[model samples]
Target: MKLFQKLGRMPIGLTIPAFAILLVVFGIPIVLLFLASINAPAFSATNYLGFFAQTANVRVLFQTIEVSVVATSICLIVGYPTAYLIVAASKSVRITLIALVIIPYLTSGLARTYAWIVILGDRGVINNLLLQLGVIHSPLQLIYNTMAVYIGMVHIMLPVMILPLVSAMMGIDRSLTAAARSMGARPLTAFWRVFFPLSLPGVRAGSLLVFVFCLGFYITPAALGGLRDAMLSTFIAAQVKNSFDISRIATSAFILLAIAVAVLFLLGLDLASAQGRTATTAWKSWVVRISKLDMLKRYFSRFSDSYRAKLWTTQLYQAGDDSRLSNIVGTMFVLLVMVYLHSPGLIVIIMSFSSGTFLEFPPSSISLQWYQTFFGDPSWRGAAWTSIQIGVAVAILSTIVGTLAAYGLNRTHPRLRSFLTMTILTPVTIPVIVVAIASYYGLVNLGLIGSRTGIVLAQSTGATGIVVVIVSATLANFDRTLERAAKSMRAGPLQTFWRVTLPLIRPGVIGGAVFAFLHSFDEVVITNLVSGYSIRTLPLKMWENIRNQIDPTIAAVSSLLMLVPVLWLIILYLTWWRSRLRDHRSRPELET
Candidate 1:
């Protein structure tokens, strides 16, 4: 009662409501996934044993690990240097570089992977250009190989690696390098000895982030690689969706989950050790200074006070200047990265407008033929409408459910919070193919296969993890007292949420909604499984086009699909900007 009284004074925003939404949308579905994995017509260890019975499944699992490791390593190698360069650069340069890194994030993973197919295909751009330049008389078999899969995956996952690396590098102290240099070390030597060691944590963090993400990838490999190059995800998709093998699908999913959990545990341990060491060293230095104080006090006290004061003032001024410069540069770099990241999509947009039948660098003038053709085709229109319907339902449902789960987990300091959060994030950690497979069998038994609602349900399952992350982040900074105030005023729980919480966290909700929408919209792997012939979504259509032929219509569709998310992003950013402006006007110093 006393704690409740105290909590009543705390302000609440969207935390409770957001968490409630997460519980229903994310928590329940995940619970169901595990239950389904273990549930069968007969109680047996057969499902679990089946996963190991097949040599091919074992091989596929290893292949998934191998590819993920290789891709993560490549991304780390390329991304670390790039992140280091950005961090070391002037504010403007760093921002531009960061933006470049993020640009790829805006593009569809499927569209970008498909673009690589064009670049690496036999009669595609690279080959055509090479032949034209007399570099090769014959077209090379670049597409449908491991090399193609690696290229596509690396290109898509690079941004993931760079963002985390940059975040890690940003936490490093610049003075460490300066101090090393002042101690008679060359710039390169100082960076290697001082900076590199400090930045290794970021490297590990970034590499783990990329590797975990790549392990679940489906589209790039499916589109670009041959049958031999199939990763775990592809195998899962085949087993569950195509073969209707529920037991195998469930077993494989559990295995993947086990592996992911093990890897993540190791990563967490490493990060903790690194952070602990850093903290301990700082503590030791503090202890040494305290211990030595009396011996040097009389001679150095006055000088030390004056020197410390001057240093503090100098550092404060420098930090202020650096912040302003960083903002200006960051804005510019964001724009540049937006442009570069958007280039492929932009090219597809241009291709969609081409007056020609074949894809070319620049269109011969412009025509609305593709647009007209796209709209006029009943099949395309049906698919587009179906995708929109599914995306909207999944987005709304995921946002609502994910918000609830986040609140439940966050509000209580239950011993299971970490475990629950990990469970919620399992959809993200486990390969998409595994989920697709499990759901496929689950849906088949339920007689929901090929149903649009089933696809939406499956997508919502995958999208819940993202929503949980977003809502949890929003809730973390949210003040809890507002709900108590509303409750004091005689409002019920639901009433308090709608009246007090929703408005404050609307931005986060919108952001989460956008992510959910995009996750559902761009989803290919799960959709491929659950979608019946009559319920093909836009991505499915585009994928079918890729698998059958190289058509420009896919470019048009990809351009359109890409625009939806980009527009949503712009709107969310604008909303955030407006909110910040309001906050600034209301409290100027607080804004600063």
Candidate 2:
């Protein structure tokens, strides 16, 4: 009774709800996948064996790896310098630069890929411009090739690459570079030797993220690449959605899962080693200096004083330092990138409002005729409604699961923590095509295929990992002691969590929910496989239209779809801005 009472005093918040949702949505679907994989009528490892039986399957697997690795490498090479530049910049400059990196990801990926088609296609902007310049009499075959795939994949994955690298770079000590410089190292040499080594973890993290994401990518390559350039995802989609081959699909799906697990394990090992070394050194030093209380106090005070001084100076400069030409140039460059990233999506939006029937770069006149045409059509309306329904369900379910998994992992001991984290992150690592095939096979055997519930379930499974990442990041800033304090105050675990933890991490939860919603909303490949005749998601409808007919209605639908994510981003930004304002007002100097 006492132990139960004690446990009851622990905080509970969204964790319980999260776990329940995970069990019903993510856990069940995964279980179904495994069961279907192994429980075929003539279960004799045939499905697994058949995966290896085809030379084409092996080639597709290798090709997927090759494209993912190459794209990830390119992202790293480009994103690293960008991240470094952002982290090294002044506060305003950093924010603006970070915004530039994130703006591309804010738009619909399909729309962006289509824009690339316009730019890289035979009669597209680049080729047309080149021909006009007499650089070449003939247009280059840039689109529907490996080069187009690489370019589109790199563009789509660049934000993911930049985020982790920026996070890692921000953790490095700025003084380390100064110290090296003082020791007679040139700026370039010091950066290469001292700074680069420190930033490698971020590089690895970013690279893994980009690679994993690229492996699952569908629309970009499908739109831009040739038949020979089809990656594993494209192949898997064809096998399951087009050919209806369950056994082969399972085998390929498992292979993707295996590869993801292996890569994540390797990355986990590196992160553990790096963190352990840092922790151990700090702990040892603390133990050795236990007796020197006065010295420690003095050292801390001096450090605090120095940091305070630097912070004050930085503020003054930020308030009045508009004359720095480098800062101006950096800001301009960031803005230009933002414009470049946003132009294609903006073009799509503009074209959606075109009075003309076909797409034009600069529409003669803007009208809402296309929007009216789309909303007035039953198929488009039904698809949009269905997408919304699935997106909402998936968002709520995945957010719950993610929040629970995040809390559990955060509060638990180190034992199996890495494994749990890796498991939750596996969806992101494995290609979406594999997930689609696996879920399709599972749902079909259960007579759930084409059902709305099944489509929602599949989307939720793939989206859970993203929710977990977002929720965990939110909890990273949370204070555990608040829960303990509530418990000490005789509050029940559930009460403490509801009153303290949930409110504190609400932003993270909401952010995760928003991301999950968008992910499920934009999802096309998986939904195409698992969804029956009854359930057609918006992206699937758009894809069908693209494949069967080229209409301005797609442009209209995509423009509206693009608005959903952008609106969510605006809301998030507003929330963040409001929080910052509150924080500033609370501070003594800022208040003045």
Candidate 3:
């Protein structure tokens, strides 16, 4: 009893290994990198000054932010209607629409970006059609411009906006809208007044996520934009390749990092307000916060009286609700958005089969020549093998570390949970360009750059964070009684975990591993810097081929790369089904 009491009195120490990993693998390198900024160039702060002193450099940072905001806004505008349509659809239609959204989500981002180039470039699909039709005298300057970057970015980010909204909308009780209707509010008014307000948390969270991700975007901007339109990643890359100046590179990175941290901190203030589920605690906390603000409370007090409420409905909602015109228009709009998001990859698939060495919109003939060459060519085959090995290694290592981190953090006290969660999840916010640059310098010092170990370690830094988030989220509502029962029967912790806990949480664990695999496999910037020229992954190969040679072989490679994740998505769906079945079977056992 005394020993058990002592054990109970002390906190669970499961987080030790995870904390150590973050501190050593993640924390030390970033700190050293940041320190390099201040200490380089004879230990003065002038490097940072020099960075800001250049108007061109400062413009790049602001332009990056502007483009990110624009992309995020476009995503939201396009996503909301799609999400709403998904919610309003019949079960079969809803499932199909969701699968459509998810297919693109799972597809290779590099392939999609590359496809946009095919569609938007000088000799690309759109221009070729227009020129043949005599619509223009010459090919439009579409690719290698700011517009190209934004379009490519919005295409990639649309799913992020929609998924969160779908989850939020699904979690909402339609009764709230019905209640508003019962009280004489029109459909549009009810949506705006009730459903929309409730979905703000999802909106806020999605916007922040999309915006931050856009700011760090290297691949799309690098591929699509011209010299004048370069993003922050361009500056970071230039400094790395040309200048060999750690101080300036790190300072630029520091600025990007600072912006991300500030946004994250601001958003953290109302984090609970954005979750899809109507968490009682979240609402209560939010209520308390609002009540504390005198001005807000005073403004809200107008709604306290029941008699003063009026049925408010917009003219558009009044005309559209239950109307044939609305359904047709909405369906058409949704389809268009879906096609816009999905067309690039589809276009690539079609072109890959074309017989022409140069890009021809429609092939006069068809052949498997490119596919044959892809398999027969040694360099392509070697790169593919390298990507697979690295992806597998990162996935395995990330899953182990991330699962441990999630389990440890999940068992921890709520008071310390937020801090520790931030520490573990810090990698997600830090720019990848920054990580790549730092990894290059830091690994060089340790003589690990260009080695498999260096690439794996660097890539795992981000992947592990993602896995921890996925697993920890699933563990939030997990039942602990089974573990206690097994303990009562003299089963050790590891045995109990294997027999009871792991079985239940395996869905999240597997999902995280699949995602981690995809992360390393699709990754390019970090792989470019850390792997150096000696090692090349499929994405790196594709990028090099596109930039240097510009051939149809890349299209063949991209098509195959896109297929792998679809298979993983199938596995994820099966795991989800199994998880649901287990939960269903366990309900009665718990009730008893």
Candidate 4:
């Protein structure tokens, strides 16, 4: 007890268990995998040199970087404006906008990638439309190319880019732009000078995250990309399958992990600064210096003062109707982007109801035949049940461990908290493909290979930090006075936590659970590595189906899988709305 108090009265009981769980499950596996890389039979760089010296390996590395950069650039170009519109909207509209972005974010990634198949296939929507318009006599090759890969990557990654941007944009004061305008700056000038510079931190941060994610991308690229389009992840997967050369596999896995970590360092994005304030300050200061440059001064000075004033007052230069129209267009563009993001899932939904064999653009007849096929197939049914069972177990385990870690971290000292937080988020920062490799080798040692338990264990490692972050945010806003009051009434630590703290942060717990389940259900990279034929999840099943089969049954499964996240989101929305309503209703009573 004295030792615990010396540690700044941290929740050691809660903290240690969570740490132990992650250490044993996540931390140890990565360490073992890393050791395997260096601790070979001869203990040399033979494996790594032999692997990387190949011309093919070097080309794939460059290709992966090129693809990642292109995808990240596209996400920033698209997400920045959408985030601006979201921040500028009314309260209700803002919530709706966020929901719109997050729905696709939470939906099953496999189902989502499958939706792309329906749209980008030769007889898919684009080809069918062009054929009908008499623009083409034959179907065009959309998928199995570089352009298709970029589109799929950007679509899946846009929400990730927007989320951080929203956070960064929300911090900037709108009055700053008005202040700039009042100082004789034009509307575009004010926005460019004031707004755009402040949002750079978000831009940089989002770009880093999106690029890292795209680097390790597998599912979408696998579905739509040809063999020539294969990235490092695809290369790694191929290597894993063809050879059980432990040192070689570990070397490849470690290389990917090192690259991911190096990215975070190069971007100066420490996990300790996940809140973005430090990153914002760093970039904001740098941009501020550039604004004072002679080049900018000379350019602005090019326009004479009187001419500038006259130009600003002209009909073409005035910013009333033009600004409103631009805003309207911008909002419409965002709406179109949302439609583009959701087009695949919507296409899948329609195709699921069709009475057809192919994933036809327009079904000759509309019926429930595909749905019936999904229900009747024993293989599909078993895969889905295994996914559900594994997902639930992952959710429960992650929540328990994450809640403890969050509560403990919140109560600990800043230095200790930062270190612990870094450890927790380490799993998230590393590429999933790397983690999958580690998992495969680690599970082999534990004799859990090809087991459902292995699947859950691997997924929980990736998901637990999400819960920690969410619950930690909740705790940040919690009223500590209530806990003190309970303590003053002679409540024990356990009693205070159970009766007071738990109730207050139940929403965060629920959010964490939902995310955990979603992560487990949609996860494929790790599942592909750890699972056997008998232990296939819904995503693994879909992955196999997409390789050769082009049937409505898979579309039906994709459509149904999309509904789970939607249902979870709807429940969260309703609960939040009801709470807001109740809070509003009670305000008048409190005033009286």
Tens-digit lDDT track of model 1 for 556-584: 77777667655776788798998888767
Please give the lDDT score for candidate 4.
0.83
Candidates by lDDT, descending order: 4, 3, 2, 1
- Taking the tens digit of each residue's C-alpha lDDT, what string does model 4 give over 367-462? 898888888999889888988999999999999989988888998788888788878877787778887887777787788879988888888887
Using lDDT as the measure, the top candidate is: 4
* Model 1 local distance difference test score: 0.73
Candidate that beats the other on lDDT, 3 or 4, i.e. the better one: 4
Which regions of candidate 2 fall more than 4 Å away from where they truly are?
A: 1-54, 127-140, 269-273, 276-340, 487-489, 577-592
Best first by TM-score, ranked:
4, 3, 2, 1
lDDT of 3 by residue, 1-592 (tens): 4443342334245555556655555677778878888884467888788888999988998998898889999999989888998988999999889888988887888999999989998899999999999999899999999899989999999998898888877878899999988776666988887888777777877788788888789989989999877889877887778877777788898888888778877765245643434543466568677776867866886785354453233342455546787899989998998898777887888788888776576776887888999999999999999999999999998898788778877777776777777777777766677777766776787788788888888888888888988999889978989789988999766777789889989999999999999999999988898886789888898998878878789888888877786799889999899889888998999999
Check candidate 2 and list the clashing pairs: 8-493, 10-493, 18-400, 450-532
What candidate 1 gets wrong by more than 4 Å, as runs, is: 1-58, 90-96, 189-194, 197-201, 269-343, 414-416, 445-447, 480-500, 588-592
For each candidate in the order shown, give its overall lDDT on alpha carbons. 0.73, 0.74, 0.82, 0.83
* CA displacement after TM-score superposition, residue 351 of candidate 1 (Å): 3.1
Residue 295 local lDDT, model 1: 62
Q: Candidate 4, residue 92: CA error in Å?
A: 2.8
lDDT of 2 at 209: 73
Stretch of 10 with least lDDT, candidate 2: 6-15
lDDT of 2 by residue, 1-592 (tens): 4543454444233245544434454456666665566655555776667777889888878898999899998888777777877897889978877776676776668767767766676766678778878999999999889999998888788888888889888888889998986665556778876787777677777877787778787788888899888877777677665776555666666677778768877764355437734644655567667767867776887767766566655664354455476567766755555566677677777767779767665678988998898989998898889888888999988877777678777765566556666666655666677666666655666677878888877777667778888888888898989889998999876677788888778788888888898888888777887776567777877777766666778778777766776689788888777767765766887557
